[model samples]
Target chain A: MASALARTTYNVFFRRSSNYLVGIFAGAFAFEIAFDSAADRLWDMANKGRQWKDIRSKYIQAADSEPADDEE
Target chain B: MFTRAAYTTATRAAFRAPTFAQARNASTQAANGAFGADRKAAAAWFAKAAAGSAILGYGISNYVVTDDRLAPVTKAVAESMTALQKKAAEYGIEMPFTVAHAFSTADHGLHPPHYPWDHFKPWKTYDHASIRRGFQVYKEVCSACHSMEYIHYRNLVGVSHTESEAKELAAEYEYEDGPNDKGEMFMRPGKLTDPMPSPYPNEEAARAANGGAYPPDLSCIARARHGEEDYIFALLLGYCDPPAGVNVREGLHYNPYFPGGAIAMARAIYDEVVEYEDGTPNNASQLAKDVSTFLSWASYPEHDERKKMGLKTLAISAMLLGLSVWWKRFKWSYIKTRKIVYKPGKFDEV
Candidate 1:
């Protein structure tokens, strides 16, 4: 009975350890894909001339004038 | 002790390799191969490892860390974008642009560039030529946009004039809504009741006039920028072709001494933009010096008096503190030296 119990424990440990390794690899791959997507979005906004108008014209006009003194 | 020895032996057994000589020989062979046919492969593996690590690092750090990795890049991008703006500015370009202040309403954002404190050379009094030039810039250039909302007429005495002279200068402007005959509200001369006016009547009018660019009120710009008198002085002079190899994008012009080096204001001063009454050339540097001085004075009109009072208070406090320390030391010494002679066991014998 004790021998059978030891065999069962060994089998359970081996199965779980193999699954953990597989899970680690899958998790890493999923994380990489997500990271790539986010990086692409950031790159588009930053370097690729996404909204030149918002960055350039609006504030220059505001700087030349004055902000609204009236507050809500 | 037996268990510890067994554990150590087991760990060593797991780590044991072949004979030392064989291991060394194998390692040498491996090194030779590594330098030869395996070099490219090894380098590729290293590159792959680095790339993988960077991706992982980016994921973990970006999620966990609040610090921005792209600040310098963001700053560069903002500066570059400014050149595309077509606002009517005194700078050479005429393009304009707009965005909400990159800084949040709760935060004033980044520090503007300025001359290092170590670079400062102190002057004894107002440089008259600079002062005259400053007065001109103040009256013409800055007066059009900003309000010196806190300054009182009584504060202008020391910058360019005596008290009586300041009063004469003060007499030029009048105040509104003063005390009535019944000690209620009425109108009066521009005594202490009035602050400086906004260049525009109101925000809508200001925006309409400037093509939607809101010129910041000058009232506290000097203070807000953490300027020394010379900092303002340097910034005005520092405006030029954004320093060599320095890239200013879109609407931003680079002035190295400007708190941010990307002051949105068109470089307003130029060589001979305004003819100085004192026969000084109205060069950008000279105008900058003058305007900086005038702005400083305008920001803290009674600055000289306040500085003097502060110095006097400091000196008095130092003297008092020194006297107190000396007295305490003398008292302590006297107490220590004056040993009370007494018999140890005779309580009532004295």
Candidate 2:
């Protein structure tokens, strides 16, 4: 049953040489994007509050409020 | 039967004649021309298809299916993958995924907790205001014992101080200068060119003043230490009374963040130790943080510039990668799309 499914898959995607080449290129592109994003997400999670992205909003808010306080 | 034999001989003789050979060559040339035209047409079609597909893929991905729209789907996929890995690990299966531990818990002292430093991010610049305050903390507090030998007053200009401010700060100290007209060394007011003056003239003096424990230079303390800025910040506030059964040597302070848990330099920063010119909080932790930042800047003056270069490299590489991908597809299209037919019987007949 697995062999039959594998044969069908090969025929659908790999039988044509052009289809095989395109699949390889597209797969590589997708893998690079996926891996990079995954690793970045994991790093961001590990350093949860230590990254600039985590604190940028609060920093901007504080800066915004400071002028108001000075005016008061 | 005789006439048929004569006709066969004539036909065989015609096959070896120059005119017959010329006709064969003409037909072969015609066939080659047709094949060439077919290949040219195929190549044009392939080029068009490749360019159209690339444009369509880029357009669809950029406008129709944008990153923000796909973010949730990508996040869900990542979460599921992580969950699957965790489940596998629970069943004594080893997944080929590992993250380096950020905080180390060694046999010596506790690892410093990670703090969200603004400058730690690749694209983020140092909080110049904080750095300025940190310089104050270093000047008023740390410089009493530790010497920043590698740092010059001029180095502070444009980073934590203005040129005039740095010059004024430099002038506060006195430096030994060469003899002018006399063969003797004389003391001169400090200049921007002079390195930060040592508290003691030499290491021996430093050790003698601090009871035989030499104070390390503060110039590269951030890099020299195990935990970098985190360790420095923690060591400043990590001072506590010796635990039960632990005998700290006389004149040594106990800071858990330090290796061996016994530091020679006593707690330097305290609440309101040095008042910030910018009216920043004067708490112990704040002072520690500022000093750590200042020392970090001293150790790595080009931190911001390095990150900026990294951002530039990534941006340029991404564009080049897209161009290269398109070029590769275009170059490979002809070879990849071409079809080969097997005509074994025809070749055998020829």
Candidate 3:
């Protein structure tokens, strides 16, 4: 019965819906890419008050405080 | 005619069990199932859209709040300007009188609001009082709009206040937040214990408040404007209506003294913007005087050290110039006397 439901007739019945959903998914992927890029640039520009060296040192110190990750 | 009854009976038997309506219903159900599945897919897609929008919103908020990349550039510019000033001096040239002018017309780069360097006519009442007034104004008014996020709480003491005083001042505001019990997150009040809080929660708030005007940080505004208290004073005072029949030049706003001067901060502070706690008048000149003094103090908070350094530099340079002049005279005389002394064995004979 499952095989029968997945037959060529299924494609004919559902092709329009599948295409519509796939297009929406594609749009979401593109939108996320553009949004991430813009967000990165804006964050870079706005949080520029701290000196690079200072921020780097801070991050390094912060990272040092965290336990090392051990993977099998 | 007797066989017709038999044919009708055969037809009834063929159509007895399954009706034609049932076949039509099965087809409609298949279509409806497909449509329902599509609607579910669409709903799942919409949920993803909502999640993506949330992430994007978070990203934008983070971007608006962060000022991560400006520090290096600011430091580089400061170092470059210092080098240029020294080089100019070495070449017997005066560096541009105003930092604003230099920034506006520097051969190196271009920025908007391009008022030429000519706006900087040197008016030397270059004193410290004006800076004190500016500080007062800052404490009273401008600080409300602008936050010196780059400046440390202790740096205020570097200006004039004592260490204890600075500490006391630092104790005023609470900072944002840190890890809470159970290692969770939450907002906390800022303290003078913390660095200055950004006035706006984010850039959007800043833009929204000032009609898209970025009221620049006053921490380095005085320094960036070439350490000129008078120019700062003049600009503060210059925000006035242009006089009638005095046509403002193209690409310039009407400032009587600012060279090709135009400004966007719509004449913010008039003569009597606020009353001084002390006996100082709230008049324009008084406001200008106080604010200028405040700005000067801000520009050179280590005012005494700067003055001492200036005096020392002046004394050394003048001494060198004088010594060079005297050395030249002495060399000329020595040469005149030694003309014959260089004649072989003349000194031995003497």
DockQ per candidate: 0.01, 0.02, 0.03
Model 3 C-alpha RMSD vs. true structure (Å) is 39.9
Give the higher-TM-score candidate: 1 or 3: 1
Model 2 regions more than 4 Å off? A1-72, B1-107, B345-350
lDDT of 3 by residue, B1-350 (tens): 53878878987775454334443444344433433545677577779989999999898767854556666778898888888888888989888742554344323211223232221212122232333345567666667777766666555442333344455566666665657877867765444356656678776788788766576776666677643555666676665566665565443445543544444355556666776644557777677656655554455555544443454456557968988855554444423322243455545555
TM-score of candidate 3's A chain against the true A chain:
0.45
Q: What TM-score would each prediction reach against the true structure? A: 0.43, 0.59, 0.41
Candidate 1, DockQ score (0 to 1)? 0.01
Candidates' chain B TM-scores in the order shown: 0.49, 0.69, 0.47
lDDT of 1 by residue, B159-220 (tens): 34334434555566655574777888855556533466557778788777765656767766
* Model 2 C-alpha lDDT per residue in residues B1-350, reported as the tens digit of each score: 45888878987775443343444444444443443555677578779989999999999999999999999999998888789888998998877773445654423688899988877876566665667788888888888898989999878765665555677788988888988688899998899889988899999999999999999998888889888999888889989997887788998888778878888988888999988865778999898888888889888888866765576568659978988865554544444434588776745545
lDDT score for candidate 2 against the true structure: 0.75
What level of docking quality does candidate 3 show? incorrect
Which of candidates 1 and 2 reaches a greater DockQ?
2
Task: Judging by DockQ against the true structure, name the best candidate.
Answer: 3
What tens-digit string does per-residue lDDT give for candidate 3 at A1-72?
Answer: 146766554565446888657767887899767755664444344334321221333223332443232100
lDDT tens readout by residue for model 2, A1-72: 147987887887799999899989998899778766765565455546533344333323333443332110
Quote the lDDT for A41 in model 2.
62
